[model samples]
Target: MLKLLYNKKASAALANLSVGGRLPHAILFEGPQGCGKKLAADIAAQYALCEGEQKPCGVCSQCVKVERHTHPDLRYFTVPAGKKEFPIDLVRQLRQEAYIAPNEGCCKVYVIDQAHAMNASAQNALLKIIEEPPAHARFILLCENRSMMLPTILSRVTAIELELPTVEQCAQALASLRPQNSPEERQAAASGAGGNIGRALSLLETGKPARAMADAKKLCELLIFADRYQPLEILAGYDKDREGLLAMLPLLKGMFAQIAVSHYAKTGRDERVCNRVTPAQALDAAQAVEAAVRQAGQNVNIPLLCALMVERAKQALH
Candidate 1:
């Protein structure tokens, strides 16, 4: 069964394409990371090759193969590990492959993961294939941003934009994925991840959410009153795992969000448990951390992100 969260606009639009008996030769599934662009691309590929009366009837051979990544007609390209960009030569090879007939289906589906990773040269190389795709060829370009794409490339493909899922939605999805986790634990993990299911799952599976929360809380307290380099010293623990570092930022945001929430309570809340900082300060700190995370996605160096984040948090909280 294929289920997605918080992407109704794209669902309705893509559904219309299949129901109306027309499918585009090239599609750009543009969205932030972990927003299910790749998942939607997989579903579209299966829908195109499904032979059943209802397209993407999951039990069909085509749908099953796509699910298992065993489909002969589906081709996927991604930047190899340690490579920052999708090489231009790969695009040239893909252009050659687009003309070939499908091994078992009506069309050849090429799914490009992280099209933003395709530098200018690589994107220019891909421009021709997308501009004049073969009759039996379909392309899905999974991207975090479309602004990086060439205007010529943008003009040729159907664009399916996806937005982030809500915290409640992320929590619900986490419950299904990890029934072993208690509802409270799942909710905590979900909130800590700021509605990114992939990050929440990473935190849960590695048993790092609780640890990250404790550490982030400590860092916040230290920022309120500690040595100048203390916050950076704490951040150095996450140098080896980028995802752990990523999760730490949101969990820290969650901490400040809690502070913001508690700051407004009338009389009964414990200010000690939530921090003594004003709501405005807490909110400012949260926004700073968010900005740092955004920069990290744009290829900011990890050391710089850590230094910037620590300094920002210290300034806002202190």
Candidate 2:
């Protein structure tokens, strides 16, 4: 399963554990969304259940069952949608199930995805299970942001940080998935995905890459031209989708960085496209844009954020 994609750090960690017998009973895999944390956890679970001397032998009955999500000892949990928190009752049920002997394997594996979504009470309830998990039980917690989870939960588990893949790697992986797409299409998808394979695939699945790319391109033009009219127009595009606006700010900042780098490389020094701006102007613009992106995560008003970004970009162009 590790070979199915490139996760060098996780692959190496698992290999080292298999050889040294230092594997932890509980683990927390943290990373940006759509980077394949769940896939890695599934691979680890299969390794734990493999019967032969070689773990995760794809042909082994245990591995096959796990692959099919039919392994009796493998349980999965996730926070339900529309609810702001995981209920304590769910954690209590898992704790009860943890003590029962594995019906078909040497270990019982529980994977809890979106663990950060758990509220304080639910987290505390799960903390007890982590503190004294059954001898044959193993738990894997997956979260997009470790900081959102309780420190007590973090302190008890071996944490693995997954990073977004490089653009080249993401392009290659995405190309394989879209066998019919042209090279240019694949490259565009990869760039727009920003190293997230799941997001790349999602864009492909929704047939939204073309639209997303168009939006990104327009955004770039607005930043470059310092058009006073563009921000209001952009705000209209984002007004109906508050959540999308929050996600898009980082992508815009990244695009601005790319533009700045290109400008620097070509000129050997920063020069404002518009009259009277300085290198410091460009730097300040980038920093302000990025800060606004971070601030959006804190629930700042979207229109206000967009207005600030436009004003900063215009200042940089002066």
Q: Identify the leading candidate in terms of TM-score.
A: 1
| Residue 278, candidate 1: C-alpha displacement in angstroms | 22
Error at 44, model 1, angstroms: 1.0
Model 2 quality (TM-score)? 0.65
TM per candidate comes to 0.69, 0.65
lDDT per residue (tens digit) for residues 98-197 in model 2? 9999998988999998898888898999999999888999999999999988999999998888878876798898777787865545555665566688
Model 2 steric clash total: 2
Among all windows of 10 consecutive residues in model 1, the one with the lowest summed lDDT is 267-276
Per-candidate RMSD, Å:
6.6, 7.1
Clashing pairs in 2: 276-318, 277-318
